[model samples]
Target chain A: MTLLEIMVVGVLGLAGVGMYGLLISRNLIKIVVSLQVLVKGAMLALIAAGYASGHINLAQSMAVTVIVADTVVAVIGLALAIQVRRRFGTLDVKELATLQK
Target chain B: MLNAILVVGAVVGALQAIRAKRLLVSALWLAGCSAMVSILFYAMDAREMAVIELSVGAGLVTVLFVFAISIAGEDTSDVRAFVPKPLAWLLVLISIGLLGWMIIPTIGAPIPGVEPSFSEILWQQRGLDVIVQSGLMFAGIVGLLGLLADAKVPAKETAAQKQAATSIPPPPKALSQSPAIREEAHV
Candidate 1:
């Protein structure tokens, strides 16, 4: 397979794995992890497509923006998750759903 | 050969991360996956992206996950019924297979575009985007500071801390003490 093909397969596989994680995981941290995995797959695809199309700079800049946004989102999400855990006393979604207030 | 290895390694690491029992273990595996992805980006001749992925995805994201896990410390009870495992696996396989099948034919297809230097494209065409992105990052930093601000800093300072705080002269007065005093006084 060509490098592009390999990357495409890798991206798709990573997305699939991330989705599986998202569906099955109960822990909030794991959920975040799964989401990151999914985002990484999308970033990979973006750069790979850019490379193939000969617009490397456009892709790089876009990827940088994405990385920054991703970091911010992750930080904010973790902070929120920590707050949830502190208030609810558990990270499990099932427990969280049943938690009053 | 190296490309295939990196891709497989990344995919395996991601799978392991999703499957690992302990949250910490899962997070570390995610880091490993990110490292592999960075390597793949490097191999694809996107060196800048590789470094960014290494620093942000592997480094910063992992640290954030660890900190969150530490704060949310608890043994998560495994839920067997959250989603049916077999169905999930089947969906994963099918989706991957379908996407791979669709994209493989597009490999090596030539794309037509006005080929400008990457630097020019970044600085000229997308300059505004870069500025906005910088603003976004700054906003993110400010928002995070607000979100994680510790409320326990005490509206009422302890006497010793208050004394320490007051004992320190204002910047203008402190600056005046330098010429040491002269150099300080200018500020």
Candidate 2:
């Protein structure tokens, strides 16, 4: 296989693993970390796809949008984490299971 | 040379996020990983991607993480003993399987081209992705609202406090008190 394809595949594979890990984790912080993996994976995929299209502006544009949106999302996540800590005193998702409302 | 540096950095960042004791340190490590990944993008000739990752992944995300760490302080859990044995083994096995699957299929696909216009596909061809991205943004907003409400401390002793507050009589006027004072003096 070509070296380029190998990198794309590695990015995709690891990104999926990172996302899956994020989904199953009981810790809120780990979940966020997993989300980082997923975001990175998506970014890589966009870049890989762009590279595939060869000099297309459309793919590049999408990658730019993804990065900006990622920053916005991460900011919102931080806000939520702050709120969670204030109310729960911990970042454990397991505590959420016991919550009534 | 740059790729090697980025790859090594990625490994170190991953380890820090995984093994670091403090959530602050872990968040910082994740941001570092994001920076390395962005550098990798630049090396791969994805300039726009590198720009976005640096801004969002490392810049905005790290700020959010800092806010979280400030809110959370330190976690005193046994840092070393996290992730049970079964789970760790499962993660390892699953990772191996996934790597194998991804590499195998990629062996036959056409090599990627360096296109500068991937955004065209999203807006022009795959318009649905925009809708999905918007939906995701909306969902996150809703989640934030939920967090705000969740963080609120419920007022304690509500019914009794309200009842007592409502039942209490207004204080006697000074004019009314003067007569009572004179009567007591006379007695």
Candidate 3:
């Protein structure tokens, strides 16, 4: 397989792992980890796309944007997770649904 | 060959991050994955992004995860997947297959061309994105402050305190009465 093909496969594999983790993991920290995995794949894909289109500069800039946004997301998610643990004493996502009632 | 190795390493690290039993171990695996991805970014000629990913993604984020995990504790027994294990795996596989089918055909060799430098593109063409990302960072900081400031006693502790308060006997009625009233009555 070509480099591009390998990258594409890697992207898909990473996304798949992330999605599966999101679906099955009950720990809030695990969920955030899954999100990190997914965003990494997206970053790779952006760079790969840029490389393919001969706009490496634009792609790199966009990847930087993604990095900034992703860091914020991760910070906020972990903060929320911490708050949840303090208030609820459990990290189980299922138990969080009790708030709905 | 190096590109292929980096890609494989990243995928393996991601897998380990998700599959690890301990949250701290998972976080360490995530850091490894991030580091591999940064190297991959370097291989792709996105050196600037590679540096940022290495610093923020691999370094800062891992510290934050570890801190949060330490505070939250690692009691994960109550956690259970929303869906059954087999069904979740099936769904993920199906999604990957569909996405691969749609995306793989469009990829082609990068066309060589004269392009502006990274700084020029970032400053001239994508200036707005930089400003917006800064705003997002500010918002994240404010949100974290809000979350931390809104702390409440845990439900279990609150309940326990309440029960303890109620179980305590009230002061003796005579002692509870005002001392001034007793002195006035004596006069």
Candidate 4:
């Protein structure tokens, strides 16, 4: 496989790992980490696609925007998670579900 | 060779993060994964993105995760995954198959070009996107602040609690005086 093809496969594999984490992790924080892994894979794929087309700058700008957005989202999500812990006293999603009921 | 190594390292880190029993260990693994991916971006000639990923993804995001872990308390159980390990592996295999089906056909196919230079693309062609992104970032800051604020004891509640004792009446008598409290008082 070409380098681009390899990178694409790698991206997909990384995303797959992330999907597994997202599906199987019971901790809210773990779920957030899984989402970050998934974002990393998508960012890599975006860079690879732009590199293939020789639009490195366009890809870089988009990646930068994504990074900024991801940072904001992660911070907000973490803050929310902390709030949840304070309100519910546990980070377990199952426990939180029970609390909601 | 370097690309392959980086990809493998990234994959390992991601997997380790998922399997780690402690939340802190998992977060560090995620940082490692981000670092490896940033290196891969650099290898792919996306230098600016590599830098941004290294800083924001590895640095800031890790710090945030650590803070969250500290606030939320550490992982409680060593074995609390949402699904069985075999089922998770099966899901990953299915995802890999789907990805292969989706990406294989597009390889080596020529994509249309965008002729503008970096600055031109950022400032001219994508000006609107940049503006919108900035607005979204501002909203994120506001949202974080709002969430933090809501988590605290509201200022109004504290101020009301500090009201003059003469105007508010003593606590014991006030409890007996209010109809809502009187019914619940059972005295």
| Highest lDDT against the true fold, candidate | 3
Sort the predicted structures by TM-score, highest score first. Answer: 3, 4, 1, 2
Residue A45 error, candidate 3, Å: 0.4
Top-TM-score candidate index: 3
User: A15-68, model 2: which lDDT tens digit per residue?
Assistant: 645645564556666667767766676666666655554543565667766765
Candidate 4 C-alpha lDDT tens digits along A1-101? 67797798778888999899888888888889888988898898888888887777888888878887888888888888888877887777888766573
lDDT, residue A1, model 3: 72
TM-score of chain B of each: 0.70, 0.69, 0.76, 0.75
Model 2, B45-159: lDDT tens digits are 7776677778877887787777767766766465232466567657756775776576446434344654324556657766887787778778777876676564456768789
Report the C-alpha displacement of residue B139, candidate 1, in angstroms. Answer: 2.9
Report how far residue B117 has shifted in candidate 1, in Å. Answer: 3.6
Worst 10 residues of 2 chain B by lDDT: B107-116
From the highest DockQ down, the ranking of the candidates is 3, 4, 1, 2
Docking class of 3: medium
Q: Which residue pairs overlap in candidate 3's backbone?
A: none
- State the fraction of real interface contacts model 1 keeps: 0.73
Best of the two (2, 4) by TM-score: 4
Candidate 1, residues B1-187: lDDT per residue as tens digits? 8899999999899999988889899899999999999998888888989998999899989998888888788555777748799988888788878877876677675587786766787688888987988898888888778767655554776899888887965677755666677866578
Candidate 4 residue-wise lDDT, B1-187, digit = tens: 7788889899999999988888999999999999999998988888878888899899989998998898788965765567888988898889888887887676665467655776788888889989999999999999988877754454564655667643756578666688998668786
On TM-score, who's better, 2 or 3? Answer: 3
Docking class for candidate 2: acceptable
